[model samples]
Target: MAIILIADSGSTKAEWCLVEGKKKKTFFTQGLSPYFLTGEQIQNILEEELKQKMKRVMPDEIFFYGTGCANPNNARLVKKAVQKVFTGATVAVDHDLMGAAKALCGREKGIACILGTGSNSCFYNGKKIVKNSPGLGYVLGDEGSGAYLGKKVIQHYLYSTFDADLMDRFDAKFKTSTTEILEAVYKKPLPNRYLANFTVFLAENRGHYMVENIIEDGFNDFFFNHVYKYRESWTLPVNFIGSVAYGFKDVLEEMCHSYELQLGKVMQKPMDGLVKYHTN
Candidate 1:
């Protein structure tokens, strides 16, 4: 029986699935971005995490859909790393956008949006991606994402624009000096993702209007800036995939309704779609 391997890698986590002969297993591992982690680190982490899954089954084909692999150079590096693990196997490396598109649209025509640590969107035409807005990483872009919300939260907090209770809570949780905050924002690697961690606080208290407004603004930014750019005459179905989209589906759906956009579906992860793609 032929074995299949699918990996979805993000800035924070990587999920690996192995399918063979009606038996399947899943594994969780670290991110494997050459831009963020060294080749040796990726090899060590992936080898350790994948060893058990690869013990009795050798995958005939491997599909890697990941965040940092959006760039051609990064995609090549990731492909090389996967090849080292599954030697002689057919390996295809693509940006996480493909996973989102395939998972949401799934060989059907629709708009696929990913709102996680970062945000991105693409228009799919059943067979391929016909249009895509450049994901300007976490900075400058990534509207309707955790990082964007987090940035807004911080901005409001610093400017004394948020509710008093929210400000108090944020100050109590952080309690970090200005220098420390600056260091985290300017001196750290993957600052946007780091900042996105703060959005969890909002998620914890999602009922608060202050938090709600931040999320609303982020989603509105996404719609006005990215999703609405492709103005076709006919209405298009819009689907979403990512942690943020899953966690805040109600809010997203409400926003979509307000904007007169149709919300098609939401997928927490792309693994199910990948399985169907490979097996069926």
Candidate 2:
């Protein structure tokens, strides 16, 4: 059996897939982003969450694709943290955009994008990323990301522009006042994640006219600002691989139709494709 642990992660959470030959089991934990967490902090988190999942089999290799690992220094930070937990395994760390590309296009050239808590895109030519449009994280950019959506939803609530019933429902669901939200967002470790968590609630209430507008607007921004900027990459099929893209696929497709861009597959998670890529 070829034992391997593969993870495709964002800023808020990490999904781990343990593939032992044909059998696979999945687990989840807090994501480790070099931009937010230190190597020791990541090691501590993995020691607690991954320890229980490693009882039966020891992995031969670990492939970790996460946000903020594109730089060699960031990759080394992640590699050190992962090494602390899976001491014996050979670990390979890379950027999440590359993971999206490999998962969405396999060995073919395509434009790959990620719209999760944060967002990213790159031009992939079969084996590696040749060019990438820089993402300004959640605060400045991450246009179609969950955080961007959540920010819009929260603004509507705080501005009192949304329907009264919708505002009431949101209040009942989160029980969060404006003051509370301000505190969480300003004083939080991962404010982007704090904001993005509301995407779950937004998804539930997406049928509302105002919510639909918000979704459409966010997606449009992503396309016009990030994806469309990659002039040459769009000549090939543009594939999306992330939670936000998969969840609001209809809205995303709408943006694509308007932009006249060729929309490819939208996979919710990249672990399965990553597994197939690595194990072959």
Candidate 3:
């Protein structure tokens, strides 16, 4: 039986699946984004984390999909790194959005979206992504994402726009000052991740009108800027894969209803769908 290995990665983590005939195994490692890690670093992760997990079995084929891999140079960096780890394996690398498209839409035409630390969307025409809205990362875009939600929450908190009860709760939960928040956002590395971390607070306090409003506004921006731009959005099923979408599914559904969007599936992780896509 031929062995196949697949990886779906984001900026924070990588999920790996190894398929040997009918048996499959899943594991995780640090993310392998070429935007953040060097070829040496990616190779080191595969050698130290993935190679050890597979033990005696080496894959015949390796498919790696990761953020920042839309660029050919980035894709080459990831492919080269994977090749170094398994010299005998055929390595294929592509963008994480493509992986999402395959996982969410399979061989069917639909709209695929990612709402994690950051956000992105594309119109997938069965075999490939025919159109994509520019995902300008967390700095300029990524509306309706965890980072975006957290950013709005922070803004409201800093501006004292939250209700008094919510304000007390926010202070009690974070015990942080405006200076600290600004420092983390401006000076720290991976500000997007740092910003996304605050979504936990929103999750904990879900259903509160204040929290709901913030999340709803973010989702609205996401649809307005990204999803709505696709002509197929009106006719096709819009599917999503990511933590934010899965976490606030009710709000997402409400927003989709508001927009009259045909909501498909919302998956926290795309690995399971990807496994089926590849195995079949």
Candidate 4:
């Protein structure tokens, strides 16, 4: 029996699945984005967390799909880290967008998007990514993403846009001060992640007009700027894999309707589909 190990990672977490025969074992660890963690740090994470989970079985092949693996340097960094741990396995590292394409589109051509802590998209022709829309990280872009939504939420709160009831609810939920918010956004390491944490508030206040407007505008920007730029946008079924898309699915669906685009699949995570793709 061939043992295949697969990892799907984002900025916040990584889901690892080990497939042996028909049985599968799952494990999790903090994300290992090359933009944030060094190759040594990634190796350390696998050695300390993932290695402990896989007690006995050694895999013949390892596939790692992660956020910053598009760049050759980043891909090399992750590949070296994985190779260091499972010395005997043939390791392959690629961008998370490719994994989303494989998971969502399968063997068909379509548009694949990721709207988690960050956002990215690509045109996939069944086997590989053909054209890509720039993600631009959190500071410049990431429209329709958790981080983007959270930024809007905080901006409203800080700028006194929330009404009395909403203000009270926000305070009750977070109680965060301006000083702390500034520090986290400017001085902290993972500012994008820090911003994305506020999406819980938006989720909780889903029905409010203000909240709905914010979400709608963000999704509109995403479609207008990224998805609409592709020549295949009207012809293809747009698929999404991310937390924000699943959490705010109603708005996502509405946005797709407004834009006259077809929404295909909205998966919170791509691990299950990826397992099938790799195993088969």
Candidate 5:
């Protein structure tokens, strides 16, 4: 029975699972994206939140999967922070993209995708990642992501592109003024995440035709531009691991059918899969 800590993080949330043999306890802390937070800040979060919750029940191994950790430097940054918290424990820090691959595909050959605050896809052949379709962050690309859907919703609202019915519903639901939205997006930190907040409304109103259109267009862009680039996209099983993908599984499956592609697992979070991968 190994004592280990497994984590899955997006730009908005980080989930922690402490496994002592077969018994697992769950904990959640704020998101730790290397793109937004410094190494010292990461350390602070671990110290303040993770340590306090876990107390003295230190794990021998700590596995951290998070956004913006693809870069070697960024991975090292996270490792250093985790090392600070766990002291003698072994730490592994990596990007959420790889997390998606490992969680969805496990030890099987498949294409893995992440469609959370951001988006990414890769071809994994059981043990390693063979091909990658770079997710150009939320600003340039990140198609089919929560941020992307949120962007379209905000665009329609700001430009009055959609009908008054949708606009009125949105306004009534959020009760957010244009100026407030602009301030949160342009002025505050993590505008991508700020924009992703609109996805809650979009998800709630899934039955709306305009919402369906937005979902279809966003997923089409992801499939065509990102997923289709992988050589095994149609040949192997393709799995989705993220909030947006799991939330809109029906729509995502419909898009896959249109491409004559079969879909695989659709996990809302990668923590459980990761725990299984590491423990066994």
Candidate 6:
């Protein structure tokens, strides 16, 4: 039986799906990236997490969409890792941005945007990506992402900018001390993701005005900084793929209205869309 595997690798986690005949199974593992982990480390992790999943079948084709694999060299390195496990299989490795594009836009012509731990936008013209607003990772870009919202929240919290009730609730939930927060930002690896983790606190306490403001600002940032920059005056249907965009659809929609941008649809995961694309 022919098998197909789709791997969506992000900075924080990787999702793997195995489909054979009519049966489908999914597996998740730690992220594999040359920028963050050595080749050997990635191999060990993949072997531990995926070896069991591959025991009964060999995939005939594998599609790898990974973060940090935007560079050809990085993509090649990850592809080599995948090939080790699925020897002789047809493998296609590309950037996660492409995955998001294909998952959201599919064969239709529209804009695909991802707002997650990081954020990015691209113009997909059915067949290929025509224009991309460079993400520049979390440091320089990723505006309107979880990290951006978390950063805003922390800044406001530290400077005593938010209302007293909101600050009290936030501090109580996260208990994020100044020293710990600073260390996470300055000393730890993947600081943006670290900061983004804080947004979960906001999600938990969405009723608070401060958290609402953070989300609103983040969505606005995404609109003005990234999405609008690409298609300023034109009104194109926009589809979003990511946790932030999907979870906060109402907030995003409200912000879109404020910016005069039309809201199209939101997808929680790209894999479902990918499945629909192939099946339908």
Model number with the top lDDT: 3
Residue 150 shift from truth in candidate 1, angstroms: 0.2
* lDDT of candidate model 4 versus the reference: 0.90
Error of 5 at 229 (Å): 1.0
Q: C-alpha displacement of 119 in model 6, angstroms? A: 0.6
Clashing pairs in 2: none
Off by over 4 Å in 3: none
Q: For candidate 5, lDDT tens digit of each residue in 58-106?
A: 8998888887787899899889888987997999888887888888888
Model 1 per-residue lDDT tens digits across residues 6-85: 89888678888888868888988977766788666777787787766567577899989987787888888888877887
- Model 3 agreement with the true structure over 1-280: per-residue lDDT tens digits: 6799999988778999999889999989998889889999999988898899888799998888898999999999889889988999999898999999999989999999999999999999999899999989898999999999999989989999999998999999999999999999999898999899899889999879989888888999999999999999999999999999999999878888999999999999889898899889
**Candidate numbers sorted by lDDT from highest down:** 3, 4, 5, 2, 1, 6
Local distance difference test, per candidate? 0.83, 0.87, 0.92, 0.90, 0.88, 0.82
lDDT measured at residue 178 in model 4 versus the true structure, 0 to 100: 97
TM-score (all chains, Cα) for each model: 0.92, 0.89, 0.97, 0.96, 0.93, 0.93
Candidate 5's TM-score reads 0.93
Q: Residue 99: error of model 1 in Å?
A: 1.0
- Cα lDDT tens digits for candidate 6, 11-117: 77889888776788899998887788876777788888887767867788888888888888988888888788668689899898889888887898788999888
Listed per candidate, the RMSD to the true structure in angstroms reads: 1.9, 2.3, 1.0, 1.3, 1.7, 1.8
Clashes of 2: 0
Show the colliding residue pairs in model 3: none
Q: Mark the regions of model 4 whose C-alpha exceeds 4 Å error after superposition.
A: none
> Which lDDT value does model 1 have at 36?
88
Error of 2 at 71 (Å): 2.6
